[model samples]
Target: MGQKSGGYDLNLFANPPNCNFVCSVCHGVLKRPVRLTCSHIFCKNCILQWLARQKTCPCCRKQVKRRSLVYVNKLRKAIGRLEVKCKNAEAGCLATCPLAHRRRHQDSCPFEQMACPNDGCSMRVQRWALAEHRRYCQHSAQWHCPLGWLQ
Candidate 1:
């Protein structure tokens, strides 16, 4: 469970999770985990997709039926409390947030790098700095008027 995959080590959080909490299919933090009648857990979507192809528990290979799946709300809440590094950490973002909020935070993270809006400028700017960069960007002069247009 400590192994790295897709730039994230699911077991490296402030509160390390047991192997049971990791999704076998994606090998990542279990998002919306569900439990099978066989007592094995998997991400809800993962197991659904797996069941679509084969009707067996991924871990024990026990025969499973779609109706036997149950949402693991307690486990999901526990995982949500664990603190994890932002996915953009390598991009200079140093924030850490709860697993439940990680996706939302990443979507609005100020440190996320984005391409300059000006047609000729190739500079990459952090999301927080994009507005300032656009203000003085020389290439923007062609499309942006400093004075208000009367028409």
Candidate 2:
């Protein structure tokens, strides 16, 4: 089975969400909800991707066309207002905010993972530890040029 996508994890919700807010495709909180002519709702990306493979509603199996998809703004807003834990919770970030603000929180979250900047390094370190990781990176100038030829 294809990995479910385009929705927040159910475990991220601070409280249980309404069944209406769950996407049938991903079985998680809807990200960008879209309604089909069949009256079934799914995350926008999930439905579109599914349509690309099979042009029918996964739930009702109704024949669906791309033009028949409609964005459900009110439902989207409702889902957005639901509280959710930070995606970096596992990385020691304890912040929680509305689902709508999750991206904003992640942008500044100290525990957010970031790619190493050193040209030859491929490590992913948390935002707060990036500087320290950079200083000790194996690709750093000091490690690559111990003789100080480049310094």
Number of the top candidate by lDDT? Answer: 2
Tens digits of per-residue lDDT for model 2, 60-79: 89999999899999998888
Specify the poorest-scoring 10-residue window by lDDT in model 2.
142-151
Clashes of each: 0, 0
Compared with the true structure, what per-residue lDDT tens digits does model 1 show for residues 44-124? 877888899998898899999999899999999988888988777777778888888888987899988889977889999
Worst 10 residues of 1 by lDDT: 1-10
lDDT of each: 0.79, 0.86
Candidate 1 Cα deviation (angstroms), residue 101: 1.4
CA RMSD of all predictions: 5.2, 4.1
Clashing pairs in 1: none
